[model samples]
Target: MTKPTETGFSAPEFLTVDEAAALLRVNRKTLYELIRLTQLPGVLHIGRSIRIRRDALLAWRPGNGGPALGESR
Candidate 1:
């Protein structure tokens, strides 16, 4: 059986900077560095903060063909 979460606030698939860093197995600072260098994509700027789309991250994987969210490659 699975245990229920206590926080009650569910996390979104499209993660914020901190959350995306954790998912990508990189430090948040490193992610920022990547953004500065333009090594990565999906950088949506909604003010002073940067956000990476979950779909974009997943599509960047090898052989994915860079499709939109929920679209089969």
Candidate 2:
């Protein structure tokens, strides 16, 4: 979950690529492909590492009558 700080910036709960892939029920490679296609939410790059927000992954359900992670609200 993300928490609002005194500076008004949110600190989102970030998950590793492997963890995110497991939550999406897809392999890591597939998740990477989705990220590449812009269908999935983009990763947060911290130096040489990448991370995804857990909330975004939870919101990404296709055919659920709602927009996906990176879609416009």
Candidate 3:
């Protein structure tokens, strides 16, 4: 389920790679690197598309310097 924002509009709980990258303020390549480094929480699967949770991204704070908590496999 999505959460309502200041505008009272909810955003999807899961975001595509492009949407996640834009929200993270990083290029797609960098986003992938972060996922690979396990610095950012990710949902991955074989023969399936990848998705990032909005809550995880919202919880992430730049410069905090810690691995995000979430299942990445």
- Tens-place lDDT digits, model 1, residues 1-73: 2223458755454568897888889898878876776656787888987778776776765344444333445
| 1-73: candidate 3 lDDT, tens digit per residue | 7878889999998888899999878799888777777677655543667788888888877674554534344
Best-performing candidate as measured by lDDT: 3
RMSD of each: 9.5, 8.1, 5.8
The CA lDDT at 46 in model 3 is 37
**Model 1, C-alpha of 34: deviation from truth (Å):** 0.6
Candidate 2 ranges beyond 4 A from true positions = 1-12, 63-73
lDDT of 1: 0.69
Question: Considering only N, C-alpha and C atoms within 3 Å, which residue pairs clash in candidate 2?
Answer: none
After TM-score superposition, the amount by which residue 47's alpha carbon in candidate 2 deviates from its true location, in angstroms, is 2.2
- What is the alpha-carbon lDDT for the whole of candidate 2? 0.75
Could you tell me how far off, in angstroms, the CA of residue 69 lies in candidate 3 after the best superposition?
A: 18
Name the candidate, 2 or 3, with the larger lDDT value: 3
Q: Model 1: how far is 41 from its true place, Å?
A: 1.2
Candidate 3 residue spans exceeding 4 A from truth: 42-46, 64-73
Give TM per candidate. Answer: 0.62, 0.61, 0.72
> For candidate 2, which ten residues in a row score worst on lDDT?
62-71
What lDDT tens digits, residue by residue, belong to model 2 across residues 1-73?
7778779998668888898888778899878866765666646879988899776777866565645544666
